[model samples]
Each structure stands twice: as structure tokens, then as C-alpha cells.
Target chain A: MPGQRQSQPLLALRGVSKRFSAVQALVDIELEIRAGEVVALVGDNAAGKSTLVKVISGVGPPDKGVIEWQGAPVQIRRPQDARLLGIATVYQDLAMCENLDVVANLFLGREIHRFGVLDEVEMERRTRELLHTLSIRIPDVRMPLAGLSGGQRQVVAIIRSFLGSPRLLLLDEPTASLGIQQTNQLLDLIEELRDQGLGVLLISHNMSDIKAVADRVAVLRLGRNNGLFDVNTTSQEQIISSITGAADHAVAHRPHPEEVWP
Target chain B: MTNPLPTKARVAEYAGGVRRRVREGGLGPAPVLLALAVTWVVFQSLNDKFLSPRNLSVLSVDIVGTGMVAVGIVFVLLIGEIDLSVGSLAGLAGAVFAALHVNVGMTEWLAVVVAVVCGTAIGALHGFLFAKFGVPAFVVTLAGLLTWSGLMIYLLGPDSSISFSEDGLVASLTSRYYSAPGFTYGLAALCTAAYLLVSLRDRARRAGAGMPCRARSGIWVRTGLLAAVAFTTVAVLGHFEGLPLALLIFLGFIVASDLLLRRTPYGRQVLALGGGVEAARRAGVDVTRVRVSVFMIAGTLAAVGGLFVASRFTSASQVSGSGMLLINAVAAAVIGGTSLFGGRGSTWSALLGVLIIQSIASGMALLGVETAVQFMITGGVLITAVIFDSLARRTAASRVRT
Candidate 1:
């Protein structure tokens, strides 16, 4: 199945490093996402998962890195540059205008216009069609985003990212605030997207979500890559241990709490 | 989404939609309209002359100066920012025009252009400081308010007042009127026709796109209501000196501004920035450019408004854009239902808001009320409008939580 994808990765980051003032957010980060694959990024609270996503999404450029899109190195200095390079990102906050209606938010920076006048009809039609295809239910396209649930807003944000026909998707904690059912729905949608030959880089804390959908899991610890493992072959314990740096800790020899108590 | 519904069901849905919107605090212009109607009634009961044709005509003209400035304020406020400098900017622009045209002997048109350009440039400066330098909008404009007013006072010099020719372009703005019955009536008819045509075309396009469209009967009812308002206003003005050119020009600006904000991508960017600056930035919107341009619009309109004020009195003076003018313009925008928090407003809010303010002022003056009383009353009204805005925002926030 992996061989079916192109030989070159859809996106590859080599030796990416970023620092803010005295704090290093990321260091020597190496990662790859190929078409038709879901790469789950997992880490402890302060790990560089979000920083890496930001670098890829062009919210922040890496201080030292070679980011290759397809097979060619590219510079993504701004969000527009990333967008033009067919990379879409859904930030943890959703990055949506709550005051705007669903249709308006869906077509914010990329509005369909004729002679500078917005074509509301066309945009509305397209929004409805896209939502229908995704089987996402929105009460009304004209309903302001303030009236939407967290899950609905997240879905809308995802739909907005799709508007650019992006080749690679970067989702930063997409299900952080969603309910169980909504999370399930989102996970299913992610799987569907992956099947359509799009590469997905998912940042998540939920181990069950990674187990359920991720093709591979990448663990980060203290601003550095700790380990990467195939979801099918690796145990959740191993990934969690890597995330917490438990295997390398001096306390690794300590007996488990369950074993000691029992 | 486009399934057809019976008329009864459709009407019920429409009513429910309106109810939900109101509950969610999407009040739009309904509250302001009600307040306007109530104001008219209260004033009319106090002085029958308040509703008289002559007074209404004067009121129409009176709204133009402050109305234009208020319209500019709407742009700044839509981005969740305030410009305290607008009053001073207006005064400075008028002083510039007066100085160049009257004292320097510059061509009238050239002077007007230079004055307006000066305003635009000043606004760009304000925008630059706020957007690029990370200064708070309130602070930047507060500093501007003092600086520009000082400049105006300095420009006026010891004389402090300059009267221009009555028949000049500036003075003619207020002095001239389309008193001819045919012209006023024709304009009203033309506006109605244009509105009707636009609505029908929108409906047709929506239907063709397989989207739900407004019912034909609904469109007709709306068009009829608009025509009624337009014709009645024209008839009232026609009875007493017809429509003032200042009023006409003000309305034109309002319509153009409304279209620009509602139909253009640039307008959407402004609204997006107002909604959430961080979100707008992430969405690839040029936040700096939009902010700068919005300030420029506010500045340009302020100058235009100042010119109208000068035209009304046929002179520019130290007090031209001073006193209650700044408060009145800001109050008008808020009163007209433009959200102070930004991202939700129309240009018409300025017109409607200024009308309410000017009506109260006009009514009190007619009743021989003291200036202090007028100020207190206007202050009270401004407070109430702000309370409404706060409550509406709270309701909307609560709805989001649910």
C-alpha cells in the first residue's frame, strides 16, 4: 500500500529548527508525510508539535531547515506562500471569524467575485454542496458562526482549508474541544480524506484517536524528535513512553505503580 | 436545502427565523428604527412644528455634515477601533480649504482637493502608527485629536475665522436644492426602480443556482415599503424647498459606502479583521493594508464632512469642528445600531444615527430648551444605546456558549 504512493514524499522537513528569544521551540526536527497517509504527531504538553505545524503552515518559518514539497525545496515565508504551495492548515483555535456567517467564513480570503462584487449565490451553493459531500450538517449557511457548536466551527474550518484544493493538510489539535461523537465524525472524515490521496499531518493528544486512524505516530520530547513508529506494529505504551521520555529516564527501572501496589 | 415549502409553512419558518435572530441579538436596524419612530413621536407631541415640512427639510440638510463624519466613524468602528481625531481632522480640513482658497488665492477645486488629500494623508499616518507600530487605536487617535486641532487653530491664526463667497462651490453645497417637483419625484422613482431591479435579479440568480430565494410576494412587499418611504420623503422635502443638494450628496455617499462594504472583497477583509485580527491574519488577509485603508477612508470622509459644515455656515472658524460634533458623530454610529465591538454594521447606520441626534437637537432648539439640557438629553440617549449594544453582545456570546 505504501509503495502505491509516489516515491517522493508529499512533504518532507529536514533538520528544522526554531527558537524564540532564549527558548528553543524546535530542534533538528525531521519528518515526512506521503500522499494517502495520516501522520499523527504526539507529545507532552510543551513538546514542539504545534511549533512544527506552524512552521509547515507558514505561520512561522523555521530558523534552519530544508522543507521540500514533492521533491523540490521551497520557502514558505507567509501563510499565502503556504496556501499557494497547496498546503492548508487548521489551527487549534480554528482561526474563524465568529461574527461572519458560515458561507462568509468558508470563503473569507478567497471569495468568489465577479468584477469585485461578491457572488453570494455561487459561494452559498458551493458551501452547501461541499457540506453535503462531507455529510456535515449545518443548520443554515447564513447562520453566523457564533451560533455554531465547537465541532461545527471546527468542521467549517476544515472545509475552509479544503477550499484551496490543498495537497497536504496540517491539523493542529482538530478534536481538542469536540465531543465524543463529533470526534468520531472528524476522525472518519480524516480517513476519507486520506483515502482520496491527500497527505495529513495531525497534531493530537488522544492516544485512541491515533490508534484508530493514524498510519504512523511521531513522538516529540523536549523540542526534539524522540521516536517514530508504524501504528500497526507499535504499542500505545511505547509511544506514550517515548512522548514522556520514560525509556531514557533514570527512573525507568522503577516498578510500575500497579505492580508495586498489587 | 432548496426544497419547496407551502406558503403557510414558509411564513412560519420566516417568523421563527426572525425570532431566533432577535434572541441571538442579531437585531440589525429594528431597534434603532423603533427608537427613531419613538423620538419622532415624542418630538412631534412637544412641538407640532417638529414634524412640519419646513423643519423636516432643514433636518435633512442638518444631518449631512455630522452624518458624513459619522459615516466615516462607522468604518473605523467596524474594525473595533475608535478615532477620536475625526472632529479635529474635519476642522483642519475645512481650515485648510478656507486658508488656501480665501487667503492664498488657490483655485477653489484645487483647494478642496488638497484639503481632502491632507485628510487622507493624516489618516494614513494614524493607520500606520496603529497597524505597523503596535500603538493602540485609541491612543493614536487621542494624540491625533490634540495635534490636528492645534494645527487647525494655528492655521486659522489671529483672525480665527474666514468667510468664503456665498456662491462658491463649498457654500453652494448647502444653499442649492432641487426645488423642481419633477426632478425630486423622478429621483425617488429612479431609486425605487433600481432597488426593485436589483432584488429581482438577485432572486433570479439565487434560484438559478438551486438555492432558496425570497418569495416574489416578499420582494414586492419590500419594494413597496421602500417606494413608500422614498416618495413620502421626496414629497415632504418638495413641499418646502425640495431636496437639498447636501442631503443628496450625503445619501449618495451612504449608498456607495454600503455597496463597498457589503459587496467587495476589501470590505470583507475589513469585517474579518474586525471579527478577529489573529484569525484574519492567519487567513491570509493583509491586515495592515486593510487597517491603513480603513483609516484613510475615515480621514477622507471626515474632511468631506468638515467641508459640508463649513458650507452650511459659509465659513470656517475655530469652532467649526469643535464642541459636541465629535461626540455627536460617534453617538450617531452607535445609535444607528453599528456595533462598537466591530465586524457588524452598515453605512446607513450613520445616516439613521445622525438623523436621530439631529432630530433631538432640532426639536429641543425649537422648544427653546437650554443647550445644557440638550447635551444632557443626548448624553442620556448615548448611554442607553451603549447599554443596548452591551446587552446584545452578551446575548450573542451566551448563544455561542449554548
Candidate 2:
């Protein structure tokens, strides 16, 4: 009861860094996301947004730094390790097989088997229920993922993450290809998930989307953390400048006068 | 401008839907089925003997050898990979079985088991190199195709062939037949009963789970059709030998493998891997294990096919599984509806594909057609199958976009 009363951030990253061969993909990144909050990670191209995500999701571990779950240091060396810690990721590409039907894609590796046989009926039932709960409408659950629209596929991918009842969901550019209506639907779903007490880390280039649902915005530039700002008070111009490294350039002028002239 | 009657409107809608599906290349196996029917009619007209019970029975038995191998190929093809070594492995299997049984003096059954196991091990070896070492499957299996052929030759030695005993189980597998009409008819009835029962059970389960179930009338119609086909086939076979043991074994394998692909978790994993390897891996599928195990299954089945081939000929010859065996098996799998591109096929495709291939060969032979012509015809059909597959996939993609 005492431990429960001592609330800690759901996930915390302290001084995490990663390098791929000659590229410094991520450097000294610090981020914290608490329960019932949406943390939007915004960055420009080649700004190591995905690299930082991969580090946290354990697709690739950080070369240096600590990842804390419930304020305790934990090593996430693989995707399974992240998954075991209730960290679910929805990739930008949706990470779904086109030929497989909705039900099959929904329960790919974690298929339900009864008596060593795939329980299709049960999976389909659960898929319908999940879709209903999320207010996602699909023409047919039996239709292959190939036949679904970009928005529907993304929704299916997001729902698949929830099948594991993850405590934290990481969505990378989920609304990239979606239309305005679908984007609004996705943002609403993210808000609903936040309200349900799940920590959500949304990686996006869309500042408007970040403003729509994010509790806090973490801007990444040149593989390092630029600034973390509350979504309510942070100006759009400020967030854009931070993402474009303009804020860093301006700040460097004040920090060092000799370097400014050179 | 005017509303039609409810029944009439429904009928019109259904007809339009069917037309739309066919135009969009959503016909799936319907085109193949139509082609098969046209082929049968053309062949039957060319030679009345083509449809005779004796010839049909022989053709059915002949398909079993290649069908078994094709069934395994379906598994590999499902994962968007090819096994070029299946043909040579089949030859090696027969040679190994004969060598162990006759030359090494092992028990007959044990020899067969070991030979099959050896084939599986060879396949697993290829899978390991491909999956674990990141070797391309095409290169690995192409090398295996040559290596296994040489191994088969060495195993056969100077004799070039070995004959199984007349009463041996291996020989009986292909050569034996049940001539009793009652037994054949009873089996047909039992199969029909099983089909109806299973369909009914599925309907109940679907209904209970609040999932869509096939209409009762539709289910009955399918069951009735199956019954008719079952009885008709039995009656025809009854005119000759009631049922060839080889055909029964082949059909049994088809049913079992079909269930494995459609109803089991392993089958889903194979499809998932084939459909999208990265997605499957991210979803926690054991990619290496699935790849290795798939090759093992292909090899084991190819070995069983070798046994069937050897039994059919009553000997394991130097050229038992050479030449057209590999091409025909792969062609059969493709022609039956299994996509070369992967993630779409069934075990029944092997049966259908082999049947079409065998029927053409048998019919052409009966008409005294040249072997070269037969090859050309089979190749043409294979091309058509590929075209259909490509068209179907393109339509699916386009339809999704729309």
C-alpha cells in the first residue's frame, strides 16, 4: 500500500545514447512519461526520432545510459524484453502482413491455440470486440490487411498492441498517411487511451497532432534532446524552432560570445 | 427507376457480385476449376478411353507420387521460398531406402523410417544454412539439387536399381488395391457423413460465437455435392479396382496437410512469415525454427513421395525421380493455386495441380502424342496458372486501393 502511494514515472530514460557505425543516431537523450499522459516526440528528418524509439522499445538497446521502469533501472536488450515490461510499439509501416486477414494479423505471433489448433473463432470474436470498443469500423474482419485502408490498418496495428494489455504504447507516425478524419479519429483514440491510464509516447512530425492530444512535447534535434515543453504553454513557433535546431543556435550565441563571431 | 421484388433484387445482386469478382480476378480457384473441366472435356472427346474407369484409376494412382512432393512444396512456397532439392532428395530417399533395406540388411520398416529421416536431416541442413547463416534459399537449394542427385547415384552403386519384395508394405502402398464394392461405397458414405457433420459443427460454433456462418441451404448444397462426387468417384473406381491404396494414401495426406495449414498455429506462422517476414519477426515468431522445420517437412514428404514412386515402379531406379519429377511437382503446386509469390495456397492445390498434370500426360499419351508436345502443354498450363496468380494479386492490391 505504501509502495502504491509512492507514485513514480511509468518510464524514464536518463542519458540514453546509441550509435550505428559512423552515425551517432541518438545522443544523451532524456525523457520521462508518466501514467495517464501522452508524450509527443517531435523531430525533423535525420533527427534520431526513430533511433530513440528503437532504443526504448528494445529493437536496439542504447549504447549507454539507463532505462527505468517504475523508477527502477531495467535492461531492455530485445523486443521481447520490452514487451514483457508492457511496452507496446506500433511502427510507422504498421508491421502487418498484407495477405493475412484482419483476425490473423491481429494475433500474429501471439495466436490463441486450443488443443494445439489455432482458435480462429475466439480470435475473431475478440477482434470484433476490440474494434467495437475502439470505435473502429472495418468493412469485414475477414478481409486481408492488404484490402484495408491506411487508417484501418493503423487502427488494427494499434489494437494488436493492446491485445497484450500493455502499460505503455509507443506509436511512430501512426497518422502519417491518414486523411484528416482518420487523423482526428486516431488522436481521439490516443486521448481515450490516455484517459484509461496508459502512458503513450507518440512520435510525429505533425505539431498540430502533438498539440491535439499530447500532454508534453519532447523535441529532438541532431540526435540530442532540445527541450521538453508543456503542450498547453509551448508555442507552435517555439516547438518548430527547437525541432529545426534554430533554438539551439540562438541559445549557443548567449552561452559563448567568441564562438558567435567565428 | 423502379424497385424490384425482394427475391429478384437479391438474385440480381448476387449475380452482379459474382460477375464483379470474376472481372476483378477474385475468382481464386474458379478459373483453375474451369480450365480443368475444359481440359477433361477436350481429352474425353479426343479419346473415349481417357475417361474409362481403368485409365482414370491408373491416372489417380500416378498422381500420388508427385502429389506428395507437391504438397510439401506448398509449405515452402507459402513462406515465399523454393526448394529446388526436393526432386533429388526424392531420388536419394528411394536409393537410401533400398540400400539400407537390401544391401545394409536393415529391417524394411526401419529402413524406410531412416531413409525419410535422412531426407529430413538433409533438408534441415539446407534450412540451417539458409536461415542461420543468411544464405539465400535459392543458392543453398540449387547446390543441394546437384549434391543430392550425386548422393543418390552413389547410394544406388553399380546395380543402378533395387526391387522391393512383392509382399512388402512399401510395394503394397502403390500396387495394392481394394476391389470390394461394399468397402469402396461404404468409405464414400463415411466421407460424406464426416463432411456434413463437420460442416454442421462449424456452423454451430460460428453461430455460438456470434460469427458469420454459411447458410443452412448453402451447407446442405455443398454436402450434397461432395456426396455426389464421392459416390461417383467410388463407383467409377469400383468398376476397375475399387480403390487404389496409393490414391487413398495421397488423399489422406492432402486432407491432413490441408488441416495443418488452415487450422493449426504452425500453418499460420508459416503464412505470416511468408506474407511479411519482418512483421512476423517483430510479432515474436521464431523465424529460424519455422524456416528449418518447413524444409524438414518438405524433405520428409519428398522422401515419402520417393517411396511412392519406387513402389509404383516396384523398384528404386537410377532415374526414378529425375527429369520431369521436380518440374512437374513444382508446376503442380503452382497450377493448383499455390502462388509462387507466397502467402496464398492450400494442400488441396497439390492434389488439383498433380491431377491436372497427370491427366494431361495420361490423355496425351493415350492419343499417341509426342513427349515433347506433352511437356509444351504442361509448360503452357503452368504459365497460365502463374498469369492467373499474378492477375489475382494485382486485382487484390488495386481493389484495396479503390
Candidate 3:
């Protein structure tokens, strides 16, 4: 039953290019996300990964190139447009209401309804089902997201993407603030989504995450699509080289442990 | 293997889990008290009469006029903005209503209506200047505060004063009260049912959705306790005198505002913009519209507040709105727990903060504190409220981080 899910390409971008006022963030980009596959977009800081994600998520329209969904070319002009096209981006800021509780947060802006008042029942039920489906252990659904831990918060953010039944969940560094256990929990969720016929455009800087969860890695180096290869076939070194050119090495000069982690 | 639970069990577990998260919002008194403790203790010690109900009632009624203006200002503050001209807008509204009745020969009700509409239109004009052009609310409202007050003087036409009777329909709404026997009991029932229904519906949804839950017994107990406290206070006060009509107006304001901010998507958009402008716009919130509407709401509230003042005082005078701006409104909000930093605060804060400040003023007056001393004390309270707001935010942030 493994790999039983048949694949249809969910998204395809060919020769997409975007130039900002002072920099060309993406160039000669060709990418594809198939149904039931999780594609990890890996890059060093400022490696055009964010630019590419924005273009895909419809935050910004590409200056050039064609984007096709289900083999048909289309344009995405806004976040609303991207949502309409079944693309949901979980930004670092999380685009959530912290003042409201988890149920309220889940349904914010696009809240569920019951006779016009917030359909607390429907929103809570759906939020629970989604969280449970992802194997996210949230102690309370009524708890405001402010009370949840970093990992739990990530789960809320992740489940939110699938709320409207988006075909593609584009997560940006979903586990960046999470601890080891929470990271494992999210990795399992990411895999489960892929198993359930959902395509994920995951962006992460964590090598182990990319290695463990990414079925395929699309490497970008200096605003160009350097290579796309199966995670099993390509080495991390090669991916790093492709993501950050030799002049600007990819190895992070992390702050001294004494100064940073603590 | 994961245990598949019966429906009731599933509900129980989900409900049980979210108790911690609900506790985090500081919806309970601990945070509110913590937010107000230093001021409360200092003020209580500064004068023992601070806790006396008779003095408190007097203070409550006295603060109503000024507090009403502040309540509206809180809405503007929530979106990370300020309205300086509320005092003047209030003055203008009083003048317009009085002038319409006395000069234009309009009926009392018609005059009141005309004044409110004109005040709102002027407010809308102010909103256009702030929301449409990205002009700072502080600047626009500050300009408004001066322009509108000056306009009020212009409308007065050097008469210096206008007197009115209190038994008018407008007067009854703002000045009369039920004061009926057991009326407080009736009011208590209303508050309990409303609170219970809202909280229960919210809890039930989270349970069904398989989200988090608060402790069942705790939720009931807390809600019951709050209702009881509110009911008891009103009951005791009712024994003395039924609720003030001004209090009723304040209640209407609190409810309308809470509904506007919490229930509507438009309200959510306002909070989002207040939290951070760029992020909200990126998330597709109509930033311009949210900012503009918030100012108008503030303006409308100020006019409403001025009406209350005119009703209680029985006249609009040369000094009708003197020294009742910026500070009291800001104090009520901060004392109630709204944040100056924007994004994190509520309408409830305005009500609560107003009560706190009013009690101090009332108690001090009862203690025979000089007006000069009361001013100094209130100024201190404002500074203290801001400090608590900042600290609460810090504690909240650190807590969230964990």
C-alpha cells in the first residue's frame, strides 16, 4: 500500500523570474509539486527561497514565466488569489490572531459560521479533527494559542493550512522554533500529509529535516535553479554548494553557543 | 495503538486539555488585579474612603462624563492610534445640540439627533483625513481636538452658556434610572445568562472540534463567581439606589464595542492592523478602511459621552469640556488593560479601567482631598497604568515564549 497514491502534478512553474528594486530574487526557475509528495525547497539565507515561495503563494506575481496548476497556466495576484488557487502559506509571523483563542485563531478572517455568529462548534470540531489527523497533541482546543508551546503552535499553523482544504500547504520553516520532540511530531505530520494525497512545498534550513522528510530537494544557488534531485540520490554537500555559491559559503557562522542558544 | 474513544470521552478529553491555554489570556482577576494592584493598594492607603460605596457611587457618576470620552478613545488606541480632539468633539456636540434646540427651534429629540449626526459627519471627515491619507491618527485627532473645540466656541457665539432641563427624553435616557426594587437582581440575571451562553457555546465548539478545554468545574465556578460578584455589587448598590441611567449608557457602549471588536471580521481587521500594519496588509486586511472606521467610532463615542455630561450637568457652559480629554480616556483604557502598543487590548479594559480610576477619584473626594491633590493623584495613576500595561505585556510575551 506504500506509494499507492497516484501522482498528478499539483503545481508547475517554468522559467519564472522576479526582480526587486535592487536585486533579482529568482531566475530561470523551474519547479513542480505533485499530488501526494512533499517537496523541500532548500537554500541558504537570501537564496531566493522566500521570493520563490511568495511567487508560488501568490503574495507577489512573478515578473516573468508561466505557472501551471493541473497542467493549465494561471496567474496568482494576491493572497486571496493564492487561497482561491489552493495555496496556503504559513508565514513566520503565522498570520494568526494571538488575542483570540485557538478556535478563534483557526477561523479568524475566514471564520466558520453558524447563523452568522462565529460557528464555534463547527470551527472547533474541524480544528480538532485536523489536529488529530496530524497527530498533534494539543492539551485543549479552547486554550488560546498564546498558551501553546512553540511546537503546538506550529501544529495549529499547519492544520490551519488544510482548513479550507487546500491542495497544497506551503510551510515556511515550520519547525524553526520547535524542540527535538516537536520537530519529530511535525515531521510525522508532514509525511502524513504526503501520504494523504496532499502536496507540500516545505521550506527549511535544517539539513536533517530536509534529509528525513523531503522526498525531493529543489536547490537554488544565487537566484538560479541549480539542481533538483531525489533526497536519496543527492548529497547534502552538493545541495549546499548549489544553494549558496562558493564565494558566499552556505555553512552558517552561528553565534557562539555561549552567546546564542542560551 | 491509539485508543479510539467514545464520543463523550472525546469531548471530555478535548475540553480538559485547553484549560491551560484559556488561563493564559488573563481573562481572570489575577492578571487584572496584578495589572491594577499597585495603584489600588497605593490609592486605598492614600485614602481609606477609596473603598466606600457612597463615595464610589459619587465618583462613578462624576467620572461617567469624562470616562465615556475615554472609552471611545480606547478604540482608536487599540488600532495603535490616538484621538486628541475627543474633548473638543464632545464640546462641539454639546454646543450643536444646545444651539439647535435654542436657536434653530428644533425639537429636543430632533436637536439631539442633528447634533449626533453632525458630530459623526465631522468625525467621518476626520477619519478620511487619517485613514485615507496615512496621516498619523495622533496628528489628525490632535488637530481635531483643537479645531473641534474652537468650532464649539464659534458655535456658542459668545453666549458663554446655555441651560437645559433634565426631564427631556434625552435627559431621561442619560439621567434617569430604573431604581426599581430587585432591579439589580434582574440585571444580574441578564449578565449571568449572557456570559454563560457565550462561554458555553465557545467551550462546546472547541470540545466538538477536538481542540483544548478548560477545567469544567473551574469554568462554571469562575463564571459563576464573576456573575455573583457583579450581581452582589449591583444588588448592594441597588439597595442604596438603582443603577444610574448613565451606567446603562456605558453598558450599551461596552456591549456594542465588544461585539464590534470580537464578533465581526471587520473588528478583527482593526486589531490586526493595530498589531502590525505591514503584516495585516500582507495578510490581505483592508488597512486603510480599518484605521478610518476606528477613528469614527471613537468620535461617535465622544459625542455620546458629551451628551451624557450635558444631561448630568443640566447646562452647556463656556468651560463645558475643559480638562476632560487625553488623560482620563487613556487612563480608563490602560487601567482596564488595553495596551498603548496597539494590537493587544479590549473594550472590557475601558470599562474596568474607568471603574478603577473613578473609584480612586471618588474615594479621594470623600476623604476631602483637595482638587489639586486629586489631579496629582490621577496623574500618578495614569503613569502607573502605563507601567502595568508594559509589564503585563512583557510577562505575557515571556510566558508565550515558553
| Number of the top DockQ candidate | 1
Candidate 2 Cα outliers beyond 4 Å, as residue runs: A1-6, A249-262, B1-25
* i-RMSD of all predictions: 2.0, 6.4, 3.9
The estimated TM-scores of all candidates read: 0.95, 0.93, 0.82
Off by over 4 Å in 1: A1-6, A249-262, B1-19
> Per-residue lDDT tens digits of candidate 3, residues B123-153?
7888899878878777887788778877888
- Model 2 lDDT at residue B354: 91
Error (Å) of candidate 2 at residue B129 is: 0.8
On lDDT, the candidate that comes out on top is 1
* Per-residue lDDT of candidate 2, residues A226-259 (tens digit): 8999989979888876766668832252332222
Error of 2 at A146 (Å): 1.5
Residue pairs clashing in model 1 are none
What RMSD value applies to candidate 3? 5.4
Better lDDT candidate (2, 3): 2
User: Listing candidates in order, what is each one's chain A TM-score?
Assistant: 0.91, 0.89, 0.84
The per-model lDDT (C-alpha) reads 0.88, 0.85, 0.73
Better DockQ candidate (1, 2): 1
Cα error, candidate 2, residue A79 (Å)? 3.1
Better of 2 and 3 by DockQ: 2
